[model samples]
Target chain A: MNSRKSVEWRKKAGIRAEQGDAAKGDKLQSLGRLEPLEQLESLEPREPLERLEQLESRESLQSVGTLALNVNEQPILVVDGLTLESSSGQKLVEGMSFTLRRGESIGLVGESGSGKSLTLRAVLGLLPRGVQLAAGAVQHTVSSAMVFQDPRGALDPLCPVVKQVAEVVRYRQKKGRREARAEALKLLGLLGLPESLAREDRYPNQLSGGQCQRIVIAIALACRPDILLCDEPTTALDVTMQRQIIDLIATLQQELGFAMIFVTHNLAIAAEMCSRLIVMKQGRVVEEGLALDVLTQPNDPYTQMLIEAVLPLPERAETDAGAEVEKEANERSGAEGQRIAHAEESMPNTVKKSRMEDLKEDSESQAEGGSKS
Target chain B: MSAELQMEQVKVRYGGFTALNHVTLHVPARTTLGLVGESGSGKSTLARAVAGLLVPDEGRMSLGGRPLEKRRSREQRKQIQMIFQNPDASLNPRHSVRRILSEALRFHNMTRGRVQTEQRCLELLERVRLSADSLDKYPHEFSGGQRQRIAIARALSVEPELLIADEPTSALDVSVQRSVLELFREIREELNLTVLFISHDLGVIHAVSDTVAVMRQGELLELAPKEAFFAQPQTNYGRELLAAVPKMPTASGLVR
Candidate 1:
């Protein structure tokens, strides 16, 4: 607390910095980047409609209105005052009420062990051992299927993907193997997977995680279910793959008109993908509203915490890392704002250039570090 | 066999498939180094190699700055501890929390008698933010977050200086993950333990790591000061990785 002690603490921090403590150094370094994150503080949160504008503006040919094709028909699966309990008589989910209309999407966001997954499993009548739907009418128009997070673990390793997909058609539609096989290829293609995978008599081991997940989606769609349950399906995937899978699911919902109950802990993914959102905490729904509204103006403190945790590094941070060594050298501008503006103007191409430069720099650094050691 | 561990040009191979190629890493006394990479990037392999579970074909490994024995001795093996990806699988099904945590302490000769072992275990449990009542319960009785705390307790029971955690919180929900990461942070500071945190999640790596080494396809891509890695990513892989993160539009008046 004294002046000498404060000076000692500062000296210790400097020594730690010299000793290569990145947490200390990064705290000292982030002063500049915090400028932008702070700039965010002054800017008003844009309406979801405005966010939608960016997406829509990017794709004029994409049918936005058609996305709501089967939005408000009827409750495809209505849970009327649902209450679930474990065999030990402990209540899990209570008084849960929701209507998932055909082609509409609903996200169930919650913390771990909050009974979000159990609520979805109750609809599928696939509750884990000793857990049952005590009181609920989980009405469904047609068959319902689940897409899980771990594609590698979800699918049977011994069977080919086509066989797995075809099995669903056979079980649900009573189709013959030959007919199901033909349909399986079509479904896989529809799910944005290659038809060549159908020809490969190889097992799940032959496929990548992304391809395996696509196969899982194909199987989920094989039954042509009016409602589909996706249980943290994209949680295990990388960001780019997660984006592609989300887009794929959205496309499938538009084309097939299957209602989706997307259960996940990721509020950002839920915000980007779902139209309606239900925020859950400790087995109770804390908030429920349109996804955009809830994400933008969340009433619940838990929901706010969830939203704040989904931090994303800005685009400029990624592209401005001197990865584009050539750009840094060749395009010399005096002012910081001008450089950033010019970079923004050539943003698309700059990203590619930066990436290439970064790769080169990484390899060079590895080589240098290796030799030095 | 020494109490420390080192990797010199460690290259892992499965027949012709190379999981790690010429990767050199060092863990000095009482210092944590965080290893990060995408899937299939050999972080797990690196962990396994250090744990003596996997032998690198073309590299030398040493403990306490001395060359490792042709085979790890029991004492040498017990000095290194690993916390795996999933707590669900790592803990035994039949054991109670007390039995599980105490067993590690007894196995490593850290405690002598049952009462002493229980005392040590309880202290560890308390340090990890678990109640004394939890000692009598089974692993399945605890939440995923609690189970991870127990896992950390078990890892610390042996008094190992170096801790290698492979995606410890990847299975957990985000809020639970924050709590568990906080636990790791506390343990690192309290024990001055050297930690090799292996994860695919950049957010997690950034939150806890002092230095981060990025790996790709059995190769060490970039190792930088955590600030340098994030502030000015020098590799294309790192750039694309940063770009792949979905940006939350800055409140243009609200973070809402």
Candidate 2:
């Protein structure tokens, strides 16, 4: 029975590939121009890891690190010297390099316009309009999936949530409609979505932000992807929802053992979720190291600034009394107001002081105001 | 202390859905009150009611001891201003910063003549920490944080007694968010502006607010002084919300 199912799956896969080619043909005809997408589409679908394993075996005898190398372990994706350029030939991302090993997670950390998201998009062959992969090669060793910051943007507004998930399962898993529906429901259940929400007819608009994100994750998992690329998946969520989604992603990563590349501007999140962190600024990596070392003792000034910008939790109360004393000292000199003015001057371009520190300064200046009055 | 803005059991409903159910809140004169909740908890609804965009189904609201009308008069509208989560949505893309601020200045008859209006606009920009050179630029020319500053400047142009900032910093990056929050603090201190700050982020609420109110499912759960709320929340929902906040990972027993 298993052999018969395998035969049926292969036949379905072949038919699906042919249909994909036909669809690509229609796209090419409509565009009236042959693009590089044709080259990507023409490549035959093969198990990515199998090719890597064959390459490893071929080079085993000549390899110098054979004694120390773990034969069973291999990187799921290797991005080498990746370069992205705009239509005007301005380099957006230059010489980007990274690797994702099976079951490992890496975080790409940067400010806005830092090309972190662009690099992630480059790996999925989904560069934005006018942005092209000017150089570099991405050796994707397995199927991958992406979870976007806003789940609503990624989902179809008119389609039912369950139908969307089941559609991915049907196409990627080569399952029948009924089987795909069952699998989709199971995946939604695993993601902790409610029965009412996981219903077959509920549109994306009907669900809450958190529920929509869960559906998006369910769809991504339905493909059984070997690599999960999350581009600020939790950024749009509330604090509680963000924590839930983060934990859910971590748990799913553990259960499925998929390599993950999470992109975020948050240092605390990068520290908590990723084992390795890559700090990016202006389309180039400034620092890359273990998450613990990079967060605790960052080498780059930009990385340090990013770390300092994180709002420290308000769990400690001992600092309040110390701040009170400092306020008194500053008030006595009548320079408290001047200090604040000085702080404001340097606020825009550089990393300003944290909120708590500013609060202390506010109280000091208020003390000066009271004394003057 | 006199309350600058007061809500007495305000109830807002949307076709059988209670967006806000008999919620009462008050912002003391010249102080900041942070209202925090999950999405759909009616925080935005309360903000709308205060801004005269939404009329409550039940209960009364007052501004400076005067009963607020369902549709505020032009004079009453000038006493309160609102800043939204997305500055891009609130700002007009086609208008320059000078045009936006001058329009607000002229609407309230706050200034006469182009010279006086330009001076007042420059003052507004200075208050929000933007330079005068920014006057000629459009909304798209500024970054997210800068556009928000422009929005604040426009809001302050009318010199409102109460400012309603609903998740003003949520769309901004963390580094930029701190500077904006500091600007809010500075404005409150300088102008003595009574602010009703709404956000889903507790850390931001803790940092900027003198008082904090927690709401859930259209119901107000807890309201207390900032320190008191953080020290020991009175409700299970409040406790759960606080616990759910993702904490900054500290280094080897160091809290900072």
Candidate 3:
């Protein structure tokens, strides 16, 4: 409900603000709760929310009801007030709304049961058994594809990895088998799969988790869909592999220009990859804003808890060697300075208390002889 | 100083592939050793070797200065315990929490009577910060984090000298992960348990471990104090892994 109001206000203000209606824009912006106009100015139509802002800009204020109809020129996908219910009438997701323009990346972030994945599944028309689209509408003008969390499960266990990718290309692009195979190899190469692995007739089980995920991405890319829905794509991956996948998706989004809605439970990952974020809880959107703003200065208590809960990196000492390593690390990765600062500020008080409590328990246990049997 | 657990030039192979290659590591009696690497990097294999589930193809492992037998004796088995990544898989679905924990206690001969066993079970659950009421519930009834806590309780039921936790918090939410990582610290201190925590997450490794071991492609890359490892990793691969971790987003304008 709050998100809907902000979306309307942002839609109106983004138009007037960009159109140089300073007085009216500032007034509307002030009414909007998420971010200031200056910050919102950086907001691009890359995410679903920004498309809504773009939608409200094109229509008269009274004609906001026609939002779904005016999707010809902009917003490839519009999900408005989409609700999901079970056969028993239990609401699984309520009033979830967002829009996706071409080449935008939005992150849906929350805890495990927050319905982030379900929302994406709903958009793909793949709701689980008994869960039905009970209310609202999902209007899309273009084809879409999905990348799942468990790549191993999403892929066919019996199919050769390249053939699986090639099948999607052959079916969707309507290319001949040989041409599709060639195109599939090229796509796999672009995704950083080696020639040896990509060319081999290897089953999904034969490849590692990272390679399987790459093949899955290749399949999603083969469809050449306008929108990509990723549901916790990197949740099953290791940190290094996760980083690779994030970098790959970002690069592909830039190169291919596909609108993306990424679902993840990690706020840090969301902050890195998505320009805008929508925080969900109990099948409802609790907060939505620029990813940086939501992560750094969250308005919702649930979001704040998520930020504080992130395990801070270990504090590095100021030794000369340490500084050298830090310098090398920073040069290799540009985000180190911000990372250190955030880690310093967001160290949880609960962690500190637990550390102290642990020490106290340690001494007490030693006094009574340790619990080692 | 004698280490609680020691591995020397350990090697393991599956079919023709080497899963662990000439790896050596040590965990002090009362400290945590955080083992980190990408998937397929032999972290899990090393944990399995330590837990006596996989006998190393070469080299020797010793606990408390005694050589570990290829087939561990019942007493030797009681000295170490493992907690797996997925709590649901590690725990039996059919058993109640009470039964799951009491079975461990009885199998290990930790308690003589039902009353004493029940008391020990309650204490174990309390140590992991779960309510005593959870004892009657099944694994599926609890949340992922709670299930993990129960898994920890079952591992502690044996009062083993060494605990091998393989990505125990990876399945949990960030908030839940913090509490579980904290619980690991508290338990390690309270019970003086030596921990070998395996994870792909560097942040979790940093939070819970005193020493850090970096593994890559079944080989040890770098092993150092937690502070040193984070500050200046010895190997390029280790540094790359550290740099690859997604940084927490700070407020805009805090830094360029």
Candidate 4:
């Protein structure tokens, strides 16, 4: 159960010959060891696993347990020999497998049609209607929640975002309506959406794409997930917003100590967010390893190609001009860093941007008070 | 000479919300102006305003130094063509590629007859890197990248002097985006068409733009030559935006 130990489960696995030790990645578990999703649905929940969660944290439904055990070394999610096919039996994902350890983040990297997303869907037991689990198993014991790629589409247009988050908090956490709303606002605020935005009963359409995404994550957080499945959650966002969301998630993960499986096509982002990288190519695991090793010394040509394809930002000369820009970027963030600093981490730029809106409202309210006086 | 797109103090409003607030921009002749901003930053509003899809409340727009009339002539309309992000929405599902390209060609009076129109359609297909045989296919038959190419071909079919590509490659996959961007570069050079390429990705902007325009909250924060802007953006917000782009850890010179 060592964190870096490679469990050589399946001898006949396709891509594990180079994975073990060299890449520091676990070999894909073969068939028959874990239960498939369909069978697990009807089967009674595991007694000790349910007791493990219940025993660990019951002071509040949202509270996570102190990880006193050597839990980080144990696998939390095992996608062992999973194969997905269409209703027409056309193979979409073939023999895909990976193990995610508790509090250890792994990234699924691949372009379109590479089955990276389908593998995530299989883990969540929410594969699309046409797709079916053709073989293998998903052995996840704890509860999980997913943050979708398109925030707008994932949300209900009719529901106010606060109400939407409260609904999940109330349903899953079984809280009172007022308490649920309060919790939702607190969660949203931690995600850097201030009370001015989160407290207002705003629908998904009224909010920006970035705001809606934060609310979506708030709802997912309300589930108190032990495993967070993010499917290209920042793909539709602008670069700045994407950075904010990635920072928010990373901070939340640190506080909550949850394992995450992040699926994205951007290798740079994957390297930034994850410690381990699993490269998928045409429905198979092409390479899996420590993120830096996979990125720096790729064993697969496709992985190497993906690293090459990452379009770098325009190179900056670290002269007086570059220093000036760095200063300017930091100076803007420092303006309101104190007010919003407590609840956030690594959110200097975005917190300032959002606080500008708060300050605008604050000045208007003060003006109204003066007029009344 | 390729036409330069000029917007002087252009303002667009949706009731109380001022989408584009007195924004001034100039896309030089035959050059691509990368309009970069987050959502609700009025990048699309500026695009729609220039394409004459929406009227700006108060502004002057001149195409190649000629003031543009609100009610443009058919030729004037043909001079500016727009390609939207989603090809599925813009390209009619019912029409074949041939019919779509031919309709535009016939409307612009760019082709002499039916045979010439067909010839022109094939050339447009080749221009966008699609096979000439793709002319017979429907939008749904092609992959997303191919469909985007078809959309680009349709935009080119009219022989427009200015191409307004609003997030043309954003809907595409990362691998596909590069090839499509190369097509945009090639077409711009070959036709000398002024391009207003709007995107949210700075990487995409760095790839295609000669001049970069950073917009936020209905204002143009900074507009500079890509080299100058990238090295040291004048505005603090622009610098923040530049800092936000993810730098690959293991890439030779990149470290965040």
Q: Can you list each candidate's DockQ?
A: 0.18, 0.18, 0.34, 0.41
Model 3: colliding residue pairs: A46-A104, A48-A99
Best by DockQ: 4
Best by TM-score: 4
Candidate achieving higher DockQ, 2 or 3: 3
lDDT score for residue A274 of model 3: 74
List, residue by residue over B18-96, the lDDT tens digit for candidate 2: 9999988888898899999888888999999999998889999998998998978887899899999999999999999
lDDT of each residue in B40-63, candidate 1, tens digit only: 788899899888887888889886
- lDDT by residue (tens digit), candidate 3, A285-348: 9999877778777899999988877677754456776577768777867677656644544443
Judge the docking of candidate 1 as incorrect, acceptable, medium or high: incorrect
Question: For each candidate, what is the lDDT?
Answer: 0.72, 0.79, 0.78, 0.79
Report the poorest 10 consecutive residues by lDDT, candidate 4 chain B.
Answer: B247-256
> Model 3 segments beyond 4 Å from truth?
A1-73, A197-199, A315-373, B1-3, B252-256
| lDDT of candidate 1 at residue A21, scale 0 to 100 | 35
**iRMSD, all candidates:** 3.9, 6.4, 4.6, 4.0
Question: lDDT of model 3 at residue A105?
Answer: 73
Off by over 4 Å in 2: A1-72, A197-200, A316-373, B1-3, B253-256
* TM match of model 1 to true structure: 0.74
Question: Candidate 4's residue-wise lDDT over B1-256, tens digit each?
Answer: 5899898999999999999999988888989899998888999999999999999999999898888768988988988999999998999999999998899888778889889999888888877878888878899999898998888898888888899999988888878888888888888889999999999989889998899999999999999999998987887788788889887875353377
Give the C-alpha lDDT of model 4.
Answer: 0.79
Alpha-carbon RMSD to native, per candidate: 18.4, 19.0, 18.6, 13.1
